[model samples]
Target: MSTRHILLGLLAMGPRHGYDLKHRHDERFPQARPLAFGQVYTTLQRLVRDGLAEVEETGSDGGPERTMYRSTDAGARELADWAGSVTPSAPFVANEIFAKVVVAILSGGDPAAYLAAQRASHMQRMRELTAVKSAKDADLTTVLSADYALTHLNADLRWMTTTADRLATLTAEVEST
Candidate 1:
């Protein structure tokens, strides 16, 4: 999901500092898949540049106050528009990871090693996707996209497991002089 709507949503709630926004986003989106602070600030800057959000000084922090962001009327309107927009159906594109695995197998690189690394990565991804799926506040639009992506990861992990086992069996059978 693009950060545009996320920023707007944050501002829609009330004025918030950059850190506050990031924290709230993490709380909502889950830290396992948290948006980076750089990403949140960059999007916030873009929102300010777009006139969708404005930085305001807090009147009473009782110390050095930080810049807080509030959504403009236009921002609220934009958020509503975004919320009403239809979810577009898109085709999944091929990823380089699978290509790398195929190349490794064809090039006589040890399939066990390749699959070992791939399984580790895929298992981590699966955990993250599972966390996202279970999160209550996760936007379904984003969640469904993640779900589709995880389906591909699951398929690859299955292939890697099977291939690793088969290759290990074959490697064992070959007499090493």
Candidate 2:
């Protein structure tokens, strides 16, 4: 995730203080890990330094003063380009689970048992996500995010099942190597 690009996009909407930006980011991306307050301020400072954003105003209603930031013309262009770009799809499969399975077989460990435990873990997470998606009060964003996660989890479950079925062949191949 490009924090810079995301902040730029938010600034494009209008001038915003770090607090407002952080809150809005959380509201908009509920499934994402929440942005830390310090992270938000740090990223905003970097954006201003890079000329992608600038301080539009500084004021206070009654409390401490706040610096409001707005996206610059350059920032707008950058945000547009980033939004238009396509993310690479599975350029490499650097799967930790697969690596662990191979290592277990080489070490004379039980790859089958590891796969079984992993499958159970994955299933539990899937159920949790399903409940979130099925909630009556769930918004479109929550449902969509849950669906995305569930799809990936389902794929992983299928892969684990296939790998478990082929463990005998895999073990023999590893021993031969």
Candidate 3:
């Protein structure tokens, strides 16, 4: 996720303090990993520097001072453009597991065993995600996120099987190198 753009999007709602932005982000996109306080401030600082956001107010309520930020006109346009732009399709093979399999074969290790173990790991995670998706009490956003993950994992399992089926050819190709 684009943290900068997300921050801008949040500011679009209204001026918000840094603390509010982090909590709001967590609530809004539960699927994403939580952001750190430092990251929040750092990104906000950069946004302010880049003319995308600005401190609209500064005040203190008997404790630490708070600075509320709002999106600049440019920030709104950039956020809208980012929201509308099509995300380029990432290469399916551009993943650690694929690289691991290739490296294991290149290093003269048994790719079959590696593939088996990796497949088992993927299946285990899929079961966990499925359980999350199946939960009746799950938040709709969380359930949808789990479903998305499960779908990708299903595709990965299919690829694992295909790669295993062609392991012999793959082994030969690696040996030739």
TM-score of each: 0.56, 0.87, 0.82
Model number with the top TM-score: 2
Q: Tell me the number of clashing residue pairs for each predicted model.
A: 0, 0, 0
- Candidate 1 residue-wise lDDT, 133-161, digit = tens: 78987786558767887998888888778
lDDT of 2 by residue, 3-50 (tens): 889889888889999999999889878989999999999999998898
User: How many clashing residue pairs, candidate 3?
Assistant: 0
Off by over 4 Å in 1: 31-45, 55-57, 83-92, 109-152, 158-177
In lDDT terms, how accurate is model 3?
0.91
Prediction 2 global C-alpha lDDT? 0.91
TM-score for predicted model 3 compared with the true structure: 0.82
Better of 1 and 2 by lDDT: 2
Q: Model 3: residues >4 Å from true position, as ranges?
A: 168-177
Clashing pairs in 2: none
Which stretches of candidate 2 lie above 4 Å from their native place?
A: 168-177
